[model samples]
Target: MTKPKLSTPAPVIEKVAIANRGEVAVRIVRACQELGLTSLLLHSEADRSSLAYRLADETLCIGPAEVGASYLNIEATIQGALSGGADALHPGFGFLSENADFAEACAQAGLVFVGPSPESLRLFGDKISAKDLVEKAGGPVIPGYQGQDQSLRTLLEKVEEIGYPVMVKAAAGGGGRGLKVIHRMDQAVEAIEAAQREGLSAFGSAQVFLEKYLAEAKHIEVQIFADHLGRVQHLFERECSIQRRHQKIIEEALSPSLSPTLREEITQVAVKIAEQAGYRGAGTIEFLLAPDNQFYFLEMNTRLQVEHPVTEMVLGVDLVKAQLLTAMGRSLNWQEAFHPRGHSIECRIYAEDPYRGGMPSTGVLGFCHWPQGPGRRFEVGFEKGDEITSYYDSMLAKVIVWDENRPRAIEKMKATLRDCVIFGLRTNIPFLLAMMEHPEFLSGQMTTGFVDKYFSRPLKEPSLTRSDRQLAEAVVKTLNREGLGGPRPRGPDGEAGPVPSPWGHSWRSGL
Candidate 1:
C-alpha cells in the first residue's frame, strides 16, 4: 500500500489541547507557544491548580483524580478537546500516547493525534509483531519464538531450541511491566502463564513471547524522526544502561563503550526498522547491546520518549518541534543528520525514598530550589505548594546537563545535584549522588544491573564536622537576623559578624 502524503496546509494547527498533566504537559505547552499555536490545558480535579494549568492559554477541568475517569478516559478527554475547540491533541509520554484505541478515536473525532499512526502503534505495540518486522528489515532479533498456537508442551520445545535462560514478555506491555525471566525450560509454563495474566490485566492483550536473555547487556536506543514524506533520520543513540528493575535512572548520549563502527551499524539498523514499520514522527528504537558488541532489537516506542532531552542537547535539535512539523506534513529541513557534538546526562528526580525500595512519597511540596547555570536544563512538573500525589508516576523533575566531554558532564551533573533542594518529601537526590560518586560509574563500566549491584545499600548520612556545624549555626543566625529581621548575633569565630564575611553567599537549605 502506498503511504498517504502529509500536506502542510499553511500550518493548520491553530490550537492544541494537552491530554495529560505535569512536566510533559508543560513541555508541550511550551512547544505549542513556540510554534505560535494556542495551548490548551486539561486537568483533573486534583490538579486544578497545577503549574501547567496556570501556564496554558485555556484550562479545562476534565474529571477527578481517578485516572480512569480523567486521563485514561478517552471519551472525556476527546469531549474536552472538542469543548475547548482544540485543533489537535498532544498525548504526552505516559498516559495514553501509545494507546492505539485512543489514537484512532482522536483521528475519528477529526483531531490530529500528534503521534505515529494507529496502525504503526498496533503493529509495534505487540512484541511478536514488532519482532517479525525487525527480522524482515534485516535487524538482529533475539533468538525466541513468536508463535501463538504453541501450547505448554510446544513452548517447552521452543525454549529448548532457543536455549535456556530466556525472557517471557507480554506482547502488548512496555516499561518493564508484564515480564518474567525463566532460567530453565521447566519454568516456561509458569512464566508464560504469569506473563499472560499480567498482560491481560495490564494491557488487555494476553499474547506473550519468549526471547534469549542476555546476562550482561547495555540498554541503548536510537532516536529517529520521520515525516509523512518518507524522510527519516536518526539522531544518534543514548546509553540508558544505568537502570533499576528495568527502569532507567540515568541516560547519556553517545555511549562511551560503543566504537564508531558499532555506533553506525546500530543506527543504520534503527533506521531500517523504522522504514519497515512505515513509522512517522518521533520514535525510539531500543536495543540490548551484548558484551560481545552484538546488539539485538528490543522494541520500538511509538511516542515521544522521556529521555529525549539528552538526545536534543547532544544533537542541538528540538525533537518536540520536529514532531509537530512531521505531524503537519512538512518534510525535514535538514538533508543530513547532525553528529552529536558534546556529552549530555539526564537524571530523573523522583519524589521517592530510594533507600526504602523506592517507595512513592506523597505530600505537598514545601520548597523547591533548582540549580541554574550554563548547560543546565530543568524539566519540572511541580512547584512550591503543589502536591505530589500517589496517583501517578513519582517523577518530579528531570535534571539534564551538557558538556564537551563525558567526564565534565558527570562533574556538572554532580554539581547540579549538590545545589538542588526539595523539601516536604523524600527525594532520590542523595541516591543519584551516591551513584555518581561510585568508581564504576565514573569509569563508565555501568550495565542495566548497575543500580541493583551498586546502589542496593542505603545512602550514608552526610557527616558534618565541628567547624561545619559552627558555620551552619552562624549562617542560621545571620539569616534570622538579616533576612528575617531578628537581632544580629556573634559569628562562629566568636567575633562580631563582618559586613561581608568572605564565607561566600549563604547556601539556601530546606529539603
Candidate 2:
C-alpha cells in the first residue's frame, strides 16, 4: 500500500483497537495490516474464537457476551485500548460507532477516534438536529413535526396535521430500530408507542419525530468524506431501496433511478449539508427519492456504513484506508471529480432460514466456501467450526461483485450465489436469489416497501416426494453410521461438529 502524502504533521498512530465484532471487525483488522499498524481486538468473551480474534495482532477480553457489558460499554472500550497500548480506536459501524459520548471518551483518553469528531456525532445522532441542519443548509426536507412537545395529545394532533400514513421514528435511532409507518389514525397511537419503546430500548432515548411517509419512495444515499482542511468530497450515490423492516439488504452504487440532472442536484445537496455540519472523516447523507423524482433529506450516518464496499468497488478507492489517513491529518489526494466505472452490487448474507420467514439459524458453521473470481470480493467473519450465535446481527458475510452494467452485475451475482456453499446452518441465499429474479428488481423499480409488499411471508418450498425422503433418510443413516469418517460421531447439533473435514449436512434432508 502506498502511503498517502501528509497534509500536516500527524500525531503518530502506531496501533489501533477494534471495538466491534463480525465482518466489520475483520475489515478493520485487514485495513490495519495493510497500513502497517498493530491491530488490537477488544472483544467480548463470546467472540474469543472469532476469526477477527485470530487475525488481529493482539486481543483483549473487555467483558461478557452481552452488548451493554462489552461492545456498548464506553469506559470498558477506552480502558481496553489504553491497556493494550493502542494509539487509536476504530468503532466499526454499529455499537459505539455513532455514540458521541464514546468518541469524546476516546479523545479524553488521548486516543484518536477514526471517524468524525464528537460534535459531528452529536449533531447527527439526533434525528431532529440532523433535519434542522439539512433545512438550514437549504436541502429539501419532508413535511413533518419536530417540536419538543411530549404529550400524547400534542403528538396525536401533530399526526393529524401531518395526515395519515405518517412515519414515527426515533430521534436517535438507525438500522430500523424505533421506526414505524402508521397507515391510519387508528394505528397512529400504537405505532407511536411502539416506536418510543423501541427507541428507549435501542438508543436510550424515547424522543420521537414524525414524517410524511412516501409509500413509493426509493431509498438513496450519498457518501461524503472530509479532510482536516475541511475539504468535503461527494462519492456519488447508492440505491438501497430493496430493504426489509427499513434495514438495507442489497445496495448498489450509481442508483438506477436517478437521472444526471437529479443526481448532480442530490450529491451537491449532500456536500452542502456535510459542510454545514462541520463534518469530518467518512459519513453518509440518506434521502428519499419520490416517484416524481423529488428528493428529500432522511438523516445522516456519522460513520462508515456497511454498504461502503459498493462505493469502493465502483470508484476504485479504499474508504477505510482514506479514513485512517484522515485521522492522521493526511490528505486523500482525491481528484477534483470522480466518475464511477461500473456497476457494483453487494448482498448481505445472513445466517437465517429463508423458508421460515428469515428465522435466525444459529450453530457451528461447517465447510464454508466463497468462490473466487474476477470482480468478486467477500468480507467474511467466520470460518468452518466457528459458532454463529444470536448475540449479535446475523449477517455472516457480504458478497460484492462488479460488472460493466447492472444487468450483467445481477447475472454475475446470481451465478456467484449459486456457486457458493455453506453447511450446518441455513442461509438467506434462496431469498436473495428470489429477490434478484423479481421483475421489479430486474427493472430497478423497487421501492423501500418492496419486501413488505411482495414478500410478506416465508418462501414456499416444493413438496417432497416419498422417494426423496427415503433417499434422504438413507443418506442420514449412512452419515450417522460412518461417524463423518471418524471413530465417533460428533455430539449434539452445535457443540461438536465435524472438524478438519470436507463433509456437509444438508438441511433439505429433514433427517
C-alpha positional error of residue 28 in candidate 1 after TM-score superposition, expressed in Å = 0.5
TM-score of each: 0.87, 0.91
lDDT of 1 at 252: 95
Per-model clash counts, in order, read: 0, 0
Give a tens-digit lDDT track for model 1, residues 25-132.
889989999989899898899887578987889999889998878988899999999899987889988677889988888877777889998999998987888888
**Model 2 clashing residue pairs (backbone):** none
Among all windows of 10 consecutive residues in model 2, the one with the lowest summed lDDT is: 485-494
Question: What CA RMSD would you report for each candidate?
Answer: 6.1, 5.7
Residue 260 of model 2 has an lDDT of 94
The regions of model 1 sitting more than 4 angstroms off are 1-11, 149-164, 182-198, 460-511
Error of 2 at 76 (Å): 0.5
Q: Which is the leading candidate under lDDT?
A: 2
Lowest-sum lDDT 10-residue window in model 1:
1-10
Per-residue alpha-carbon lDDT of candidate 2 for residues 294-323, written as tens digits (9 for 90 to 100): 999999999999999999999999999888
